[model samples]
Target: MTALGLLYPGHSAEDDYPRIEQLLGSDIRVDVVHTDIGEDAHRVDALKEMGSPERLAAGVEQLRLTGAESVVWACTSGSFVYGWEGAHDQVRALARTAGMPASSTSFAFVHAAAELGVRRVAVGATYPDDVADLFASFLGAGGVEVVSVRGSGVITAAEVGEWTEEDVLTLARQADTPTAEALLLPDTALHTAALIPTLEKELSKPVLTANQVTVWEALRLTDRRVNAPALGALFTREPIVQV
Candidate 1:
Protein backbone atom coordinates (compact mmCIF):
# COMPACT_ATOMS: atom_id res chain seq x y z
CA MET A 1 0.00 0.00 0.00
CA THR A 2 1.23 3.48 -0.81
CA ALA A 3 1.41 5.78 2.18
CA LEU A 4 1.12 9.57 2.16
CA GLY A 5 1.98 11.63 5.21
CA LEU A 6 0.15 14.84 6.01
CA LEU A 7 1.64 17.33 8.46
CA TYR A 8 -1.53 19.15 9.44
CA PRO A 9 -1.47 22.26 11.57
CA GLY A 10 -4.14 21.51 14.17
CA HIS A 11 -7.44 19.85 15.06
CA SER A 12 -9.58 21.29 12.31
CA ALA A 13 -10.10 19.08 9.26
CA GLU A 14 -7.29 16.60 9.59
CA ASP A 15 -9.92 13.88 9.49
CA ASP A 16 -10.45 14.63 5.82
CA TYR A 17 -7.28 12.72 5.00
CA PRO A 18 -8.67 9.45 6.27
CA ARG A 19 -11.90 10.01 4.38
CA ILE A 20 -9.82 10.50 1.25
CA GLU A 21 -7.88 7.34 1.96
CA GLN A 22 -11.12 5.40 2.16
CA LEU A 23 -12.41 6.96 -1.02
CA LEU A 24 -9.21 5.99 -2.81
CA GLY A 25 -9.84 2.42 -1.59
CA SER A 26 -7.60 0.17 0.42
CA ASP A 27 -4.47 0.45 -1.65
CA ILE A 28 -3.49 3.80 -0.19
CA ARG A 29 -2.93 4.93 3.36
CA VAL A 30 -3.06 8.52 4.56
CA ASP A 31 -1.39 9.22 7.88
CA VAL A 32 -1.83 12.55 9.60
CA VAL A 33 0.50 14.02 12.20
CA HIS A 34 -0.63 17.27 13.74
CA THR A 35 2.16 19.76 14.24
CA ASP A 36 2.51 22.39 16.92
CA ILE A 37 -0.13 25.08 16.57
CA GLY A 38 0.93 27.76 19.03
CA GLU A 39 -1.76 30.27 18.12
CA ASP A 40 -4.65 29.50 15.83
CA ALA A 41 -4.82 33.08 14.60
CA HIS A 42 -4.74 33.56 10.80
CA ARG A 43 -2.20 36.39 10.96
CA VAL A 44 1.09 36.27 9.06
CA ASP A 45 3.33 35.91 12.10
CA ALA A 46 1.21 33.19 13.67
CA LEU A 47 0.94 31.32 10.38
CA LYS A 48 4.66 31.49 9.69
CA GLU A 49 5.37 30.11 13.12
CA MET A 50 2.77 27.44 12.51
CA GLY A 51 4.67 26.27 9.41
CA SER A 52 8.11 26.70 10.93
CA PRO A 53 10.90 24.27 10.10
CA GLU A 54 11.18 23.15 13.70
CA ARG A 55 7.52 22.13 13.91
CA LEU A 56 7.57 20.43 10.50
CA ALA A 57 10.72 18.51 11.47
CA ALA A 58 9.00 17.19 14.55
CA GLY A 59 5.99 16.06 12.50
CA VAL A 60 8.26 14.35 9.98
CA GLU A 61 9.76 12.24 12.76
CA GLN A 62 6.31 10.83 13.53
CA LEU A 63 5.51 10.27 9.84
CA ARG A 64 8.78 8.43 9.36
CA LEU A 65 7.32 5.72 11.53
CA THR A 66 4.44 5.39 9.06
CA GLY A 67 6.88 4.84 6.17
CA ALA A 68 5.16 7.62 4.22
CA GLU A 69 6.58 7.92 0.74
CA SER A 70 5.51 11.55 0.43
CA VAL A 71 4.53 14.35 2.79
CA VAL A 72 2.30 17.40 2.41
CA TRP A 73 1.87 20.36 4.74
CA ALA A 74 -1.91 20.21 4.89
CA CYS A 75 -2.51 23.85 5.74
CA THR A 76 -3.21 26.43 3.00
CA SER A 77 -3.06 29.66 5.00
CA GLY A 78 -0.05 28.42 6.91
CA SER A 79 1.98 27.99 3.75
CA PHE A 80 0.62 30.79 1.52
CA VAL A 81 1.09 33.26 4.34
CA TYR A 82 4.81 32.78 3.71
CA GLY A 83 4.31 33.98 0.12
CA TRP A 84 5.25 31.95 -2.97
CA GLU A 85 9.03 31.86 -2.61
CA GLY A 86 8.97 31.25 1.10
CA ALA A 87 6.43 28.45 0.68
CA HIS A 88 8.76 26.73 -1.76
CA ASP A 89 11.56 26.99 0.76
CA GLN A 90 9.27 25.63 3.46
CA VAL A 91 8.52 22.45 1.51
CA ARG A 92 12.17 22.07 0.53
CA ALA A 93 13.05 22.03 4.20
CA LEU A 94 10.24 19.53 4.84
CA ALA A 95 11.54 17.25 2.08
CA ARG A 96 15.03 17.33 3.55
CA THR A 97 13.75 16.45 6.98
CA ALA A 98 11.38 13.70 5.78
CA GLY A 99 13.77 12.28 3.18
CA MET A 100 10.78 12.16 0.87
CA PRO A 101 8.94 14.20 -1.69
CA ALA A 102 7.19 17.04 0.15
CA SER A 103 4.70 19.82 -0.63
CA SER A 104 2.07 22.02 0.98
CA THR A 105 -1.63 22.67 0.37
CA SER A 106 -0.88 26.13 -1.05
CA PHE A 107 1.37 24.64 -3.71
CA ALA A 108 -1.13 21.84 -4.02
CA PHE A 109 -3.79 24.28 -5.19
CA VAL A 110 -1.39 25.84 -7.67
CA HIS A 111 -0.31 22.49 -9.10
CA ALA A 112 -3.87 21.15 -9.08
CA ALA A 113 -5.00 24.16 -11.09
CA ALA A 114 -2.19 23.59 -13.59
CA GLU A 115 -3.11 19.91 -13.88
CA LEU A 116 -6.66 20.86 -14.74
CA GLY A 117 -5.44 23.61 -17.10
CA VAL A 118 -7.38 26.18 -15.11
CA ARG A 119 -5.87 29.66 -15.24
CA ARG A 120 -8.49 31.89 -13.72
CA VAL A 121 -10.09 30.93 -10.42
CA ALA A 122 -12.27 32.52 -7.76
CA VAL A 123 -11.28 32.08 -4.13
CA GLY A 124 -13.65 31.30 -1.26
CA ALA A 125 -11.28 31.98 1.57
CA THR A 126 -11.93 31.64 5.30
CA TYR A 127 -9.26 34.14 6.23
CA PRO A 128 -9.55 37.89 6.68
CA ASP A 129 -9.26 39.93 3.49
CA ASP A 130 -5.60 40.77 4.07
CA VAL A 131 -4.63 37.13 4.59
CA ALA A 132 -6.87 36.07 1.72
CA ASP A 133 -5.12 38.63 -0.47
CA LEU A 134 -1.83 36.94 0.32
CA PHE A 135 -3.23 33.64 -0.97
CA ALA A 136 -4.29 35.33 -4.18
CA SER A 137 -0.78 36.72 -4.55
CA PHE A 138 0.70 33.33 -3.92
CA LEU A 139 -1.45 31.85 -6.67
CA GLY A 140 -0.43 34.72 -8.94
CA ALA A 141 3.21 33.82 -8.50
CA GLY A 142 2.35 30.32 -9.77
CA GLY A 143 0.80 31.88 -12.89
CA VAL A 144 -2.80 31.36 -11.80
CA GLU A 145 -5.14 34.35 -12.05
CA VAL A 146 -7.55 35.29 -9.34
CA VAL A 147 -10.68 36.51 -11.03
CA SER A 148 -12.19 37.33 -7.65
CA VAL A 149 -11.86 36.53 -3.95
CA ARG A 150 -14.41 36.29 -1.12
CA GLY A 151 -13.07 36.20 2.37
CA SER A 152 -15.13 35.13 5.40
CA GLY A 153 -12.75 36.98 7.74
CA VAL A 154 -12.81 34.09 10.16
CA ILE A 155 -10.03 34.51 12.72
CA THR A 156 -9.19 30.96 13.71
CA ALA A 157 -8.97 27.45 12.30
CA ALA A 158 -11.37 26.27 14.99
CA GLU A 159 -14.10 28.51 13.67
CA VAL A 160 -13.55 27.47 10.08
CA GLY A 161 -13.79 23.82 11.10
CA GLU A 162 -17.15 24.49 12.63
CA TRP A 163 -18.59 25.54 9.24
CA THR A 164 -21.32 23.24 7.97
CA GLU A 165 -21.86 21.88 4.46
CA GLU A 166 -24.39 24.57 3.60
CA ASP A 167 -21.98 27.22 4.79
CA VAL A 168 -19.36 25.83 2.43
CA LEU A 169 -21.76 25.84 -0.51
CA THR A 170 -22.84 29.40 0.22
CA LEU A 171 -19.22 30.55 0.16
CA ALA A 172 -18.60 28.75 -3.15
CA ARG A 173 -21.62 30.38 -4.73
CA GLN A 174 -20.68 33.82 -3.50
CA ALA A 175 -17.06 33.49 -4.55
CA ASP A 176 -17.67 32.12 -8.04
CA THR A 177 -17.49 34.50 -10.94
CA PRO A 178 -18.44 34.14 -14.60
CA THR A 179 -14.87 34.82 -15.60
CA ALA A 180 -13.42 32.14 -13.37
CA GLU A 181 -12.80 28.62 -14.69
CA ALA A 182 -12.92 27.18 -11.21
CA LEU A 183 -13.70 27.93 -7.56
CA LEU A 184 -11.13 27.44 -4.80
CA LEU A 185 -11.92 26.99 -1.14
CA PRO A 186 -8.50 27.69 0.37
CA ASP A 187 -8.75 26.72 3.99
CA THR A 188 -7.69 23.27 5.18
CA ALA A 189 -9.46 23.97 8.41
CA LEU A 190 -12.77 23.78 6.58
CA HIS A 191 -14.41 20.36 6.22
CA THR A 192 -14.95 19.69 2.52
CA ALA A 193 -14.15 16.08 1.79
CA ALA A 194 -17.82 15.17 1.41
CA LEU A 195 -18.88 18.39 -0.30
CA ILE A 196 -16.62 18.38 -3.37
CA PRO A 197 -19.05 16.72 -5.80
CA THR A 198 -21.95 18.73 -4.42
CA LEU A 199 -20.05 21.99 -4.64
CA GLU A 200 -18.98 21.33 -8.23
CA LYS A 201 -22.51 20.44 -9.24
CA GLU A 202 -24.05 23.45 -7.52
CA LEU A 203 -21.55 25.85 -9.06
CA SER A 204 -21.51 24.09 -12.46
CA LYS A 205 -17.72 24.34 -12.39
CA PRO A 206 -14.67 22.76 -10.91
CA VAL A 207 -14.51 23.11 -7.14
CA LEU A 208 -11.07 22.73 -5.63
CA THR A 209 -11.04 22.62 -1.86
CA ALA A 210 -8.02 22.47 0.44
CA ASN A 211 -8.29 18.87 1.67
CA GLN A 212 -9.15 17.58 -1.80
CA VAL A 213 -6.21 19.28 -3.43
CA THR A 214 -3.94 18.25 -0.60
CA VAL A 215 -4.64 14.55 -1.30
CA TRP A 216 -4.35 15.09 -5.04
CA GLU A 217 -0.99 16.79 -4.56
CA ALA A 218 0.32 13.95 -2.46
CA LEU A 219 -0.73 11.47 -5.14
CA ARG A 220 1.05 13.59 -7.77
CA LEU A 221 4.30 13.54 -5.83
CA THR A 222 4.13 9.76 -5.69
CA ASP A 223 3.54 9.70 -9.46
CA ARG A 224 0.23 7.94 -8.91
CA ARG A 225 -3.33 8.84 -9.76
CA VAL A 226 -6.53 7.28 -8.56
CA ASN A 227 -9.82 7.81 -10.36
CA ALA A 228 -12.19 8.86 -7.62
CA PRO A 229 -14.97 10.86 -9.19
CA ALA A 230 -16.50 11.62 -5.82
CA LEU A 231 -13.49 13.84 -5.24
CA GLY A 232 -14.90 16.12 -7.96
CA ALA A 233 -13.49 17.49 -11.22
CA LEU A 234 -9.91 17.31 -10.06
CA PHE A 235 -10.17 13.51 -9.98
CA THR A 236 -12.86 12.93 -12.62
CA ARG A 237 -10.73 13.65 -15.70
CA GLU A 238 -7.31 12.94 -17.09
CA PRO A 239 -4.52 15.38 -16.28
CA ILE A 240 -4.17 18.08 -18.93
CA VAL A 241 -1.16 17.60 -21.14
CA GLN A 242 1.32 20.43 -21.37
CA VAL A 243 3.02 20.97 -24.70
Candidate 2:
Protein backbone atom coordinates (compact mmCIF):
# COMPACT_ATOMS: atom_id res chain seq x y z
CA MET A 1 0.00 0.00 0.00
CA THR A 2 1.16 3.56 -0.69
CA ALA A 3 2.05 5.51 2.43
CA LEU A 4 1.78 9.24 3.04
CA GLY A 5 3.24 10.50 6.27
CA LEU A 6 2.32 13.59 8.24
CA LEU A 7 4.68 15.29 10.69
CA TYR A 8 2.57 17.21 13.17
CA PRO A 9 3.44 18.98 16.37
CA GLY A 10 1.57 19.61 19.61
CA HIS A 11 -2.17 19.41 19.99
CA SER A 12 -3.35 20.24 16.51
CA ALA A 13 -6.96 21.12 15.90
CA GLU A 14 -7.18 20.27 12.19
CA ASP A 15 -5.91 16.72 11.98
CA ASP A 16 -8.04 15.04 9.27
CA TYR A 17 -6.55 11.56 8.70
CA PRO A 18 -9.76 9.84 9.81
CA ARG A 19 -11.77 11.83 7.33
CA ILE A 20 -9.21 11.07 4.62
CA GLU A 21 -9.51 7.36 5.36
CA GLN A 22 -13.26 7.69 5.31
CA LEU A 23 -13.09 9.49 1.98
CA LEU A 24 -10.44 7.33 0.35
CA GLY A 25 -11.61 4.22 2.24
CA SER A 26 -8.47 2.08 2.55
CA ASP A 27 -7.09 2.84 -0.85
CA ILE A 28 -4.11 4.59 0.76
CA ARG A 29 -2.42 4.53 4.12
CA VAL A 30 -2.02 7.76 6.07
CA ASP A 31 0.27 7.86 9.07
CA VAL A 32 0.97 10.63 11.53
CA VAL A 33 3.93 11.04 13.87
CA HIS A 34 3.24 13.63 16.52
CA THR A 35 5.51 16.02 18.44
CA ASP A 36 4.88 18.24 21.42
CA ILE A 37 3.67 21.66 20.37
CA GLY A 38 2.66 22.47 23.93
CA GLU A 39 6.20 23.22 24.98
CA ASP A 40 6.62 25.61 22.10
CA ALA A 41 3.16 27.10 22.60
CA HIS A 42 4.62 30.37 23.73
CA ARG A 43 6.57 30.71 20.50
CA VAL A 44 3.32 31.79 18.90
CA ASP A 45 2.12 34.26 21.47
CA ALA A 46 1.60 36.80 18.74
CA LEU A 47 1.63 34.27 15.90
CA LYS A 48 5.38 34.80 15.85
CA GLU A 49 6.26 31.35 17.10
CA MET A 50 5.68 29.69 13.73
CA GLY A 51 9.14 29.62 12.17
CA SER A 52 11.07 27.03 14.02
CA PRO A 53 13.16 25.29 11.38
CA GLU A 54 15.11 23.19 13.83
CA ARG A 55 12.04 21.81 15.52
CA LEU A 56 10.22 21.25 12.23
CA ALA A 57 13.21 19.45 10.73
CA ALA A 58 13.35 17.14 13.69
CA GLY A 59 9.71 16.21 13.27
CA VAL A 60 10.16 15.55 9.56
CA GLU A 61 13.13 13.32 10.19
CA GLN A 62 11.17 11.31 12.70
CA LEU A 63 8.34 10.78 10.24
CA ARG A 64 10.80 9.96 7.45
CA LEU A 65 12.24 7.17 9.55
CA THR A 66 8.85 5.49 9.27
CA GLY A 67 9.34 4.86 5.53
CA ALA A 68 6.80 7.15 3.92
CA GLU A 69 6.62 7.70 0.19
CA SER A 70 5.85 11.37 0.84
CA VAL A 71 5.66 13.65 3.84
CA VAL A 72 3.96 16.93 4.61
CA TRP A 73 4.27 19.52 7.31
CA ALA A 74 0.59 19.66 8.17
CA CYS A 75 0.34 23.10 9.68
CA THR A 76 -0.87 26.29 8.03
CA SER A 77 0.21 28.95 10.50
CA GLY A 78 3.30 27.01 11.39
CA SER A 79 4.59 27.28 7.84
CA PHE A 80 3.13 30.55 6.55
CA VAL A 81 3.80 32.76 9.52
CA TYR A 82 7.46 32.56 8.54
CA GLY A 83 6.88 34.40 5.26
CA TRP A 84 7.60 33.07 1.76
CA GLU A 85 11.29 32.27 1.91
CA GLY A 86 10.88 30.76 5.34
CA ALA A 87 8.11 28.47 4.12
CA HIS A 88 10.19 27.43 1.11
CA ASP A 89 13.20 26.68 3.23
CA GLN A 90 11.10 24.63 5.60
CA VAL A 91 9.82 22.47 2.73
CA ARG A 92 13.35 22.00 1.43
CA ALA A 93 14.51 20.89 4.83
CA LEU A 94 11.62 18.47 5.16
CA ALA A 95 12.23 17.00 1.73
CA ARG A 96 15.88 16.54 2.58
CA THR A 97 15.12 15.07 5.95
CA ALA A 98 12.57 12.58 4.66
CA GLY A 99 14.52 11.82 1.48
CA MET A 100 11.18 12.07 -0.26
CA PRO A 101 8.75 14.68 -1.54
CA ALA A 102 7.64 17.27 0.98
CA SER A 103 5.10 20.04 1.27
CA SER A 104 3.22 22.04 3.86
CA THR A 105 -0.46 22.87 4.23
CA SER A 106 0.14 26.47 3.19
CA PHE A 107 1.90 25.48 -0.01
CA ALA A 108 -0.79 22.90 -0.76
CA PHE A 109 -3.55 25.48 -0.46
CA VAL A 110 -1.82 27.83 -2.86
CA HIS A 111 -1.16 24.99 -5.31
CA ALA A 112 -4.78 23.88 -5.16
CA ALA A 113 -6.02 27.40 -5.83
CA ALA A 114 -3.64 27.72 -8.73
CA GLU A 115 -4.88 24.43 -10.17
CA LEU A 116 -8.44 25.81 -10.14
CA GLY A 117 -7.18 29.09 -11.62
CA VAL A 118 -8.72 30.90 -8.70
CA ARG A 119 -7.31 34.30 -7.82
CA ARG A 120 -9.79 35.74 -5.37
CA VAL A 121 -10.56 33.94 -2.12
CA ALA A 122 -12.35 34.15 1.18
CA VAL A 123 -10.33 32.81 4.11
CA GLY A 124 -12.21 31.06 6.87
CA ALA A 125 -9.91 30.48 9.79
CA THR A 126 -10.09 29.27 13.39
CA TYR A 127 -7.16 31.43 14.46
CA PRO A 128 -7.17 34.79 16.16
CA ASP A 129 -7.94 37.78 13.95
CA ASP A 130 -4.29 38.79 13.79
CA VAL A 131 -3.16 35.36 12.71
CA ALA A 132 -5.95 35.24 10.15
CA ASP A 133 -4.70 38.50 8.63
CA LEU A 134 -1.21 37.07 8.50
CA PHE A 135 -2.53 34.16 6.48
CA ALA A 136 -4.22 36.60 4.14
CA SER A 137 -0.94 38.35 3.47
CA PHE A 138 0.75 35.01 2.93
CA LEU A 139 -1.86 34.05 0.35
CA GLY A 140 -1.51 37.39 -1.34
CA ALA A 141 2.18 36.75 -1.73
CA GLY A 142 1.34 33.44 -3.36
CA GLY A 143 -0.61 35.23 -6.15
CA VAL A 144 -4.00 34.61 -4.57
CA GLU A 145 -6.25 37.62 -4.10
CA VAL A 146 -7.52 37.69 -0.56
CA VAL A 147 -11.07 38.98 -0.76
CA SER A 148 -11.80 38.59 2.94
CA VAL A 149 -10.68 36.70 6.03
CA ARG A 150 -12.66 35.66 9.09
CA GLY A 151 -11.35 33.83 12.17
CA SER A 152 -12.82 32.08 15.21
CA GLY A 153 -9.99 33.31 17.51
CA VAL A 154 -9.50 29.91 19.01
CA ILE A 155 -6.18 28.97 20.58
CA THR A 156 -4.72 25.54 21.26
CA ALA A 157 -4.64 23.14 18.33
CA ALA A 158 -6.39 20.36 20.22
CA GLU A 159 -9.55 22.47 20.57
CA VAL A 160 -9.53 23.26 16.86
CA GLY A 161 -9.64 19.48 16.29
CA GLU A 162 -12.77 19.19 18.38
CA TRP A 163 -14.85 21.44 16.12
CA THR A 164 -17.71 19.69 14.32
CA GLU A 165 -18.64 19.81 10.66
CA GLU A 166 -21.66 21.97 11.50
CA ASP A 167 -19.39 24.44 13.26
CA VAL A 168 -17.09 24.58 10.26
CA LEU A 169 -20.01 25.04 7.87
CA THR A 170 -21.28 27.97 9.88
CA LEU A 171 -17.83 29.54 9.83
CA ALA A 172 -17.41 28.81 6.14
CA ARG A 173 -20.75 30.37 5.24
CA GLN A 174 -19.92 33.50 7.18
CA ALA A 175 -16.46 33.75 5.62
CA ASP A 176 -17.78 33.87 2.08
CA THR A 177 -17.44 37.31 0.57
CA PRO A 178 -18.82 38.84 -2.63
CA THR A 179 -15.62 38.76 -4.66
CA ALA A 180 -14.37 35.38 -3.54
CA GLU A 181 -14.15 32.72 -6.25
CA ALA A 182 -13.24 30.14 -3.62
CA LEU A 183 -13.73 29.72 0.11
CA LEU A 184 -10.69 28.59 2.13
CA LEU A 185 -10.90 26.90 5.48
CA PRO A 186 -7.22 27.24 6.49
CA ASP A 187 -6.91 25.06 9.50
CA THR A 188 -5.23 21.66 9.46
CA ALA A 189 -6.94 20.80 12.70
CA LEU A 190 -10.46 21.18 11.34
CA HIS A 191 -12.05 18.08 9.75
CA THR A 192 -12.61 19.65 6.35
CA ALA A 193 -12.08 16.58 4.16
CA ALA A 194 -15.50 15.25 5.22
CA LEU A 195 -17.46 18.49 4.92
CA ILE A 196 -15.91 19.79 1.67
CA PRO A 197 -18.63 18.54 -0.69
CA THR A 198 -21.42 19.86 1.49
CA LEU A 199 -19.74 23.24 1.78
CA GLU A 200 -19.19 23.49 -1.97
CA LYS A 201 -22.85 22.65 -2.67
CA GLU A 202 -24.08 25.10 -0.09
CA LEU A 203 -21.80 27.95 -1.18
CA SER A 204 -21.75 27.32 -4.92
CA LYS A 205 -17.98 27.63 -5.02
CA PRO A 206 -14.86 25.58 -4.44
CA VAL A 207 -14.01 25.06 -0.80
CA LEU A 208 -10.29 24.58 -0.06
CA THR A 209 -9.38 23.11 3.28
CA ALA A 210 -5.80 22.81 4.52
CA ASN A 211 -5.82 19.04 4.88
CA GLN A 212 -7.54 18.43 1.55
CA VAL A 213 -4.96 20.46 -0.30
CA THR A 214 -2.07 18.94 1.62
CA VAL A 215 -3.12 15.38 0.89
CA TRP A 216 -3.81 16.12 -2.76
CA GLU A 217 -0.44 17.77 -3.21
CA ALA A 218 1.41 15.00 -1.39
CA LEU A 219 -0.30 12.38 -3.51
CA ARG A 220 0.47 14.39 -6.62
CA LEU A 221 4.15 14.16 -5.85
CA THR A 222 3.91 10.38 -5.86
CA ASP A 223 1.84 10.15 -9.05
CA ARG A 224 -1.17 8.84 -7.15
CA ARG A 225 -4.68 9.37 -8.50
CA VAL A 226 -7.66 9.96 -6.24
CA ASN A 227 -11.30 9.98 -7.29
CA ALA A 228 -13.04 10.22 -3.97
CA PRO A 229 -16.29 12.15 -3.79
CA ALA A 230 -16.04 12.66 -0.07
CA LEU A 231 -12.96 14.83 -0.62
CA GLY A 232 -15.11 17.18 -2.70
CA ALA A 233 -13.92 19.29 -5.64
CA LEU A 234 -10.25 18.98 -4.76
CA PHE A 235 -10.20 15.34 -5.77
CA THR A 236 -12.84 15.64 -8.47
CA ARG A 237 -10.89 18.23 -10.44
CA GLU A 238 -7.94 17.75 -12.76
CA PRO A 239 -4.65 16.74 -11.23
CA ILE A 240 -2.41 19.45 -9.83
CA VAL A 241 0.24 20.74 -12.21
CA GLN A 242 3.69 19.38 -11.53
CA VAL A 243 6.14 21.93 -10.23
Candidate that would win on lDDT: 1
lDDT of 2 by residue, 1-243 (tens): 778888766655434776685677576878787754644332254334443666666676667667789988888888888788878988898788678988888899888898887889999988888788888988989999998989888876667778887899899989998789999998777777767889999999889988888788778778897888778777887755646
Q: Which lDDT tens digits does candidate 1 get at residues 54-113? A: 988988889999999999999898899888889999999999999999999999999999
Q: What is the alpha-carbon lDDT for the whole of candidate 2?
A: 0.79
On TM-score, the leading prediction is 1
Candidate 2 residue pairs in clash (backbone atoms < 3 Å):
10-37, 12-157, 13-157, 13-161, 13-189, 14-188, 14-189, 14-190, 15-189, 43-49
Q: CA lDDT, every prediction?
A: 0.92, 0.79
Question: For residue 47, what is the lDDT in candidate 2?
Answer: 36
- In candidate 1 the C-alpha lDDT for residue 54 amounts to 95
Candidates in order, TM-scores: namely 0.99, 0.89
- Give lDDT: candidate 1, residue 158: 96
Residue pairs in clash, model 1 = none
RMSD, model 2, all Cα superposed?
Answer: 2.6
